[model samples]
Target chain A: MANITNDAAKPERLQLLRVLGPAHVWALGVGIVLVGEYMGWNFAVGKGGMIAGLVACWVAGLLYTCVAMIDSEVTSTVAAAGGQYAQAKHIVGPLMAFNVGLFLVMAYTMLEAANAITVGFLLDTVAGMTGHSGLHQQPFIVLAIMFLAWLNYRGVLATLTFNLVIVAVAFTAICVLFFAIQFGASNVPLDFSAVTEEPLPYGWLGIVASLHFGLWYYLGIEGTCQAAEEVRSPARSLPYGTMAGIMTLLIAATLTWYMCSGLIPWEYLGQAGTPLFDAARVTGNVWLMVLLFIGTIFATLASANGCINDASRAWFSMGRDRYLPSWFGAVHPVYRTPYRSIVFLVPIALIFALGAPLDQVVTFSILSGLLGYTFMTFNMVMFRRKWPLDTIKRGYVHPFHPLPTIILLILCSSAFFAVFLGYGTQLIAMMCFYIIASLWFHFRRYQYVRRGDQFTMPWPRPQGY
Target chain B: MAYEPKKQGLAAQIFDVVTLLVLTVGALYVPLYMGLAGAAKTPNPIENPTWEALGQNAAEQRQWEALGITDPASVNDMITARFDYSFSWAALIIMIVSVVGYFVLVVRLSDREYREVLDERFGSKRKGG
Candidate 1:
């Protein structure tokens, strides 16, 4: 092979600043997902009752554990803004990379829209309780999206620093609620029998279906890799931060399941708009209620904030590679942020938040996420096949490689089945949507993409080609 | 210098705009047309509303008795589990084909494009190229 050199002078390219550490990475990942503990996970209980909900939680946890381990190993080496999209580009090729990039952007953007709508509904709920029932939610939703967009537009450091504080506070509130209900000054009573009162109400199939809501428990934890380019040291920070984020989510998911299941009947708990808030309301302690309410709002805001960060990065990366319009590729010279992409996504998120039904919005987000995880399964297999061990220097190597890959594939298939149960038509429709998108990319978008220049990593040729 | 992408032709831009409009509408309407719209919850009120009475109420107790859901083992009869899981072989086959076919196309296209990149960056005489 011919030797390559950088002796020729190169033009200066504005880039995202690398100023983050493991803590910021943790905050980015956990911030995007902590909202799950406050509201969504209880849907599993409605699907299969407490025991099945617990099973689904552990199963989804195992799925995400594989995601984190595999993502960490690959991300430590790829180290780019696009996360899995970057991995797909280097390990697979343009078509898969384009789809993965679209998946990341769609998933995070839809989640951001959902978070904004949730924030609006939350404020309206607080208003209804205070006797001001006719509050307009649109302004609140618009404000939430615009403010977070502004934060992201400022810089990554400020955005993630704010995320760290709120995420820490939100996580701490969950711990406080757990400890208070378990052994606090509150005189609130608990019904420990309520947990096991109705076990596996839907049987085995219910456990399978519950895997859908179980996803809400740790949905966006893989977002940590979106920060790879911005991290001070991708090799050290990506693995450490992502693993720590998943571990924290596991504990948080369990605590949330336990506390809510103990306090409320599975039937009512499953249908609650905000189970943690309802768990606090059952206590009749005004202070605890206020804390949990704040926790819910902060968690939603944190999620929207992180979604903006990740979605914008993915869009910006794809833009940089000309997979999309080149207009979105610009990084802010002064702020060192993906300003164009951030600004461009605000209106898309706003329309979804204000126009679409909340459930559908969330369903779209979840399915998009599932597609990304499914992509990771193949991405990991290809990464191993193309660049085997010791072929290139790796920052971190996850043990039992094929094991994690197999587990991820199984869990992903199960989740697909779960989505199919309730959303069969929607599942098929989303597949068609992506197929159309892939066709568009293949015929229309491929020419704009710099084919030879798309490979950004410094690695040797694949073993087989 | 970083690799910046070339500009698109007008036809591509028009295709982009038209496809985006179609997809956005499809994303919004397909679910609704498919009956995936969110269902409004029916208010289930109980007498003497209290935290203790939230789940264990006369109405739910009646529901439990009527459905014979007194024990955890038979609780499978509860309402949420009523989703019809009747397997449709045709639908499953269509889904399998759609997904698998997409992957097949991706892999085949990727092989061709990836080799072209290798040949451009390193001469075709190179072993992998």
Candidate 2:
């Protein structure tokens, strides 16, 4: 057996402070995707109406559920900070690992950029509501990105502590909106038949179009697995935290869908940039609107914070393994955090936040996520075959074995195609980005090999390799 | 080896069960029931008693005409009734399965022996000693 000392010592050497527990892990899982509850997901309603949109959410929920289940197993078995990237490295090879790592870095950075943009827009809404001109979006976005990146650079615990509080406030706001809608604040009649009747206004193709928006509901739940190295007990905490987090999100997603759609016309909900705020406006309560606006800010911050944390960790892992410059792998001696990577990620995100349109940024984020999911799903199947569950003391082995993994792979592939159909040019651009990244890695590989340092699979290599 | 169950204090056991139940009902049952109730309240156009009740929406009129319902009063009762029944039943099944599935999973996860095995395998090595 390859010694644990050899495989695990590198992260230990980096001296990442171990502080997170199950609760923090759960919060990070939920926090990273909380913005979906406040906005973005309503766009699905425009394409498919309430019923088709809800159906898309159901499929997405199922896909994420399968992902969380397998992720728990892989996380516990590997227990690395690299998260999915590490899993890919062990199960696939160095090339695929580099691709997965880069995909995740882009995915989280794009998600951070999207949240930064949303924060600016929501703050502008607040300003407009208070009878003033909106804040300059570029400055607001840059500041938000910098602030969250600073928090991440300071420490993981600091970032998570802020996340926990913000997530609580955001979750409370969702509950308030759901109740207010249910109690007739909007004066809109419940139309159960609307769920089935003409729910697919754009026809069957609308369901496919809804995939990207539907994905917003549970996009970053897998991020919890990325914190495996810091958690107190990954095998115990990861499965419980991830599963509980997903279940919470499922309920939150359903509530957000039902309340937002029922309170106002699906058409309006679909088009509103800040859907929850619009839903609150239907109540004609200034206080509720204010509350939801605040919630939107909190949700966006939580997402950006969580993304910065996850992105830096992935970059650090890649750097530590020599896929990138070792400069990124350095931990701050005082804070014991990956300050360099966090600082590096913020400027890239700021560029995207200021330069890209909101819809394009969102599409790129989901596209990157889908690419990473595809790799992780394949990695899980390979990992299971290479290291049978019986040999590992896994906390949660997903039921039905390979069935869930296979189903998720198929669903993810179809979602990828749906995304391609919807955003062909953007998808092509993402491929180009990956190709350039791969070529750079190839160049780096040559330099490393010449120094008598070589990249090997983290797991035991197959015979005859 | 014999399977020896760990003994727990009454308070601990109660806390475990209560936590599981609360999580199951709050997270699984509430949102599902909310969705089902919302769906039930949405008006089904074909089930309307009068053509006037279906309203003057052009989309509704086009759908009615496409379905060959020339008169609201003469609309086929079977189609509307079947749709309502199937939708309601599906919602009920989904709610029940979700609640029950969550309950089972939480209970199994709370097992003391299972937790011990997890700690042994994947707990932070720094603190394990």
Which is the leading candidate under DockQ? 1
TM-score: model 1, chain A: 0.96
Model 2, runs deviating above 4 Å: A1-12, A187-197, A449-465, B1-129
Expressed as tens digits, the lDDT of each residue in A404-444 for candidate 1 is 98999989888878777666777777788888888888877
Cα RMSD to the true fold for all candidates? 5.4, 16.4
User: How well is each residue in A1-465 modelled by candidate 2, as lDDT tens digits?
Assistant: 011212323533556778888889988989999898787888777655678678878889998998888888887777777788777655555556666776777778888988998988887877776788757878889889988888888888888989999998998999987887667665334344556655666677678767767998999999998887788888888888899999989999998888676555554456568888776765666788889888899999999999999999888877665555555667787788888888877777886788666766777788778877766665776667766765446667778878888888878866765555445445544554555445544443313311112222243332222
DockQ of 2: 0.02
TM-score of chain B of 2: 0.30
Give the C-alpha lDDT of model 2. 0.68
Task: Give me the runs in candidate 1 sitting further than 4 Å from their true place.
Answer: A1-12, A184-188, A192-195, B1-6, B9-18, B33-87, B125-129
TM-score of candidate 2 against the unseen true structure: 0.75
Count of backbone clashes for each model?
0, 8
**Per-residue lDDT of model 1, residues B60-116, tens digit only:** 443333222354333322222334555577877777787678778877787777776
